[model samples]
Target: MSERTLLVIGAGGHGKAVAEAALLSGEWQRIAFADDRWPALCETFGWPVVSDVAGLAALEIQVAGAIAAVGNNAVREQWVEAIRAAGLPLITVVHPRACVSAAATIGEGSAIMALAMVGVDAAIGEGAIVNASATVDHDVSLGDFAHLGVGVHLAGGVVVGARAWLQAGCSAGYRVAVADGVICAPGTVLVVD
Candidate 1:
């Protein structure tokens, strides 16, 4: 199959990371960006910022796939849904240094960053971010658009709800349940109930 083109939605730090990952993978030939904040001025990682999401429809070019790189879960969720509704393909990205089990399942538009580990049967939901050095243990499930900050750890069978953000260095106990929209502060320790 021919290589696909990627349009990264968002032009912030996380978006730059995603663009770099895509470029390093060499799976896609063309990488462009879309953001509400226009005039990206210069390209990121050698890829130009094409247009804003509002202008996506007027491009007249085919975008093989797209990924929402927004950091906020709510915004990420919205953009992912918008792209999906537009009939555009959503793609997932895994950093070269990340380790993912064969039994693990990562949904579309999700990103597993450098040094992250996804264990057996762990299900990462669509548009979720498993940030650098984060760990999702066996049988854990992360709901759509969830964000796991750097060094965060989810023990076996843990369930993280939609749009949740587990901040950096935080660790949740085995079988812990984090409710939707929950924001665990940095360095927090969530004990199992």
Candidate 2:
């Protein structure tokens, strides 16, 4: 794969992880970032943080694609829409160690991190983030921009709403419903009655 210029939207921890993955993949060069937080650090993982999202309009650079690296699904969705409106392509990042089933469907600009497992027939929506060691079980449907933090476990047939964030080590029971924009903190146990 030829090297491409990529932009990572969001400068948070998740964004950093995505950058790391992209670097390790060796398929992208000239990785830059756009975040709402202004005057922030100029670089992360040795890659320059060029400008805020709004600043992209003024730059003379050409970005081949972008990744919504925000941990919040809603924010991810918003950024994805904005990038799309700007005519930038959305790219997906899957860590080398992640295991995705043949029947699983991952949308554009989504990232499946190291040790994550996307099971059979699962559908991960666009711009979603499945963080390190997360497990998305069989038949699970994750809406657009949903984020699964490190070690998050979604049982079989669970439905996750758009832009939802299940934090580290969180677990949802089988067939559970995680509403949109919901933030589940780390180690939270979700039991479906």
Candidate 3:
């Protein structure tokens, strides 16, 4: 394949993690950032802050694809739409160390971080995030823009709705159905009685 350059939208902590995972995946030969902060935030982990949305317009010819690294689900979804509207391909980043079953389906623009485990038949939607060390059991469904923070655990058959944020260390019981836009506090546990 040709040398692919990935444009990461957002230059904050989450952006760094996404870029690092992309780097570890060895899918992109080049990576850069495009944040709203632009000039004031010139660099992130040594990668240049190419530009904001305006800069992205100029970079259309150079970047192979783009991924929204924003932490907020709504914001990320917006960026994803913008990137698509701009005619840039959305890229998915999966860390090499992540254990994803072959039967699992990871959607476009999603990120599966290092040490994350996605079991058989699990479906992760577009722009969703499975952070480091999270465990998604078999048959689980994570909706578009959903986020599973570090160490989050979801038992088999769990269905997380779109834009749901399961904070770090949160654990959900079997067949749990988390509603859309729900935000679970860190360490929260959802046990079905």
- Stretches of candidate 2 off by over 4 Å are 37-40
Output the number of the TM-score-best candidate.
3
Better of 1 and 3 by TM-score: 3
Q: How much lDDT does candidate 2 score?
A: 0.86
lDDT by residue (tens digit), candidate 3, 39-98? 888888988898896566667348888999977999999899889888899989999999
The digit string of per-residue lDDT tens for model 2 on 35-127 reads: 777556677767778778777666567788888887666677778888888788889998878899999999998999999999999999988
**Where does the lowest 10-residue lDDT sum fall in candidate 3?**
53-62
lDDT against the true structure, each candidate: 0.89, 0.86, 0.92
lDDT at 85 for candidate 3?
Answer: 83
Task: Write down the TM-score of every candidate.
Answer: 0.93, 0.90, 0.96
Better of 1 and 2 by TM-score: 1
Model 3, CA-based lDDT: 0.92
Order of the predicted models by TM-score, top scorer first: 3, 1, 2
Residue 167, candidate 2: alpha-carbon lDDT? 87
